[model samples]
Target: MGELIAVYLTVHTPRYCTYETAFAGKLAHPDFRAVRDGLVEQGRQLAGVQPDAIVINSCHLVATFPTVVDGTPRHRGILTAQEAPELIHGVEYDFPGDYELASAIIDRGRAAGHVCTLAADVHYPLDYGTVMPLVCYLDRTQRIPVVPVSVTLANDLEECFTWGQYVVRAVRERRRRAAFVASGSVSHKLVRGPERWPSPEDQELDHRFARMLADGEYEKLWAWLPEYAETVEAEMGGRHLAMMLGAILESGRRFAAALHAYGPSSGSGNYVISLS
Candidate 1:
């Protein structure tokens, strides 16, 4: 059986690509640069694992009815983010897709009584939440193939977690070494200004959540998720984290969790963490 080699939680801000210097300048205050650098280091570690494919759960691609997997054999597009064109305009990307593994995930999810489908649209462009980390962490040549999974907003936390369990089973049944990435921020309560930070209460919540993750307290995290998501205004309704937790739990293995870095961006708490 194939094993999950590593799991990562990473931030997906265009600022990492568009405003590196400005982001780094605030290192003394919030250490944004350190977080970015730490993610790069984590990426390097992932590369060393030599995974055949990386299954990514992206918060940006929210599906309504069934969970969607990007199964295109090849992906190439120019991304101009609708949410923030100024930050991520005309960004071109080309990456190989893992059709075989993606198809297996869809079948496995359906067998498990979850709504899942494969997306083979050649014109489909990836959102920044999926692209930014790929750009920063993976090699430019894109040696490893990717299986991009979408988050379902209509699915509650439990459903999302069940979908993740299906993903884990699919990867293992295929007998392929894989790495899983959860790309999103936490405590996302947008305010008027881009430079503003989250409230002190939100910051504390972020820290506690991070601590729970580091301590491998999945039960506690799940128990507190409903209230915590509402209180902190979690990004993507906390589906990304829910999916990651599900995958970790389904693996039936204990991981040494590490909090690589954490910082704030536009009132959101961005964190870089690794589980291995």
Candidate 2:
């Protein structure tokens, strides 16, 4: 069977901490509720498909190295509950060809000055962005293997895309049944600083991107640049989208929908998206 992959859904905020007063307070600025609801629905759908594994490409988990995808060590049990104490949790899941792909991507990115690594340990918490959507899609009863693909944001688009293509090639070669989820948002315009806020023009720009993603129009996706920068303010997240897109499309699968699209009109512009 081919690799089963799902891209990351943007849960930019700490919604998992149901009782975090600080997190709850900021929820109004960027509708954490919207992101949470969308994530829950996505989780339900993923459980229904029951793929061999899931691939979550997220920047939150990006580190200096490649991780084994799951946060568990080989022989420990990693707990997901918020109250669960951190410990030497067992390696919960492992994806086929993930290590190969991560290693190659890291090497390529490093050559281009983008430092990255692969994690096989079960100690660190698989950051929330990776876990939240996971909670939404995966069945509690069935703990499938997970492959986490992360990238450092310290490089140019060409560099990131080069590394991302390597990631896609490795996953496609592994031939596991998987779905790729590219988890991120368009702009971080929501912060209180001078960052540009989302104007009606920005909304127009997001709509155009949503349309491109829906159509699987790679030519248009690749051509996005001067135009995108004009609307997107900063281009940090677009690379994440492009790299994840490359990985998913490389699997020879066609995307059916932009799935869910909602950016918190706040400057943060965090949005959630799912592709099938």
* Regions more than 4 Å wrong, model 1: 19-31
Model 2's TM-score against the true structure? 0.70
RMSD of each: 2.4, 6.1
Model 2 stretches astray by more than 4 angstroms: 1-9, 15-33, 64-116, 136-142, 193-197, 225-230, 234-237
Candidate 1, residues 48-117: lDDT per residue as tens digits? 6678888898889878978999889988888888788977778678888888888888998778787778
Worst 10 residues of 1 by lDDT: 19-28
TM-score: which candidate is best? 1
lDDT of 2 by residue, 78-187 (tens): 43444232311232532233454445445554565554555656454565455544533343443665566665555555555565565666555656566666666675
> How far is 235's C-alpha from truth in model 2 (Å)?
6.9
TM-score of each: 0.91, 0.70
Best by lDDT: 1
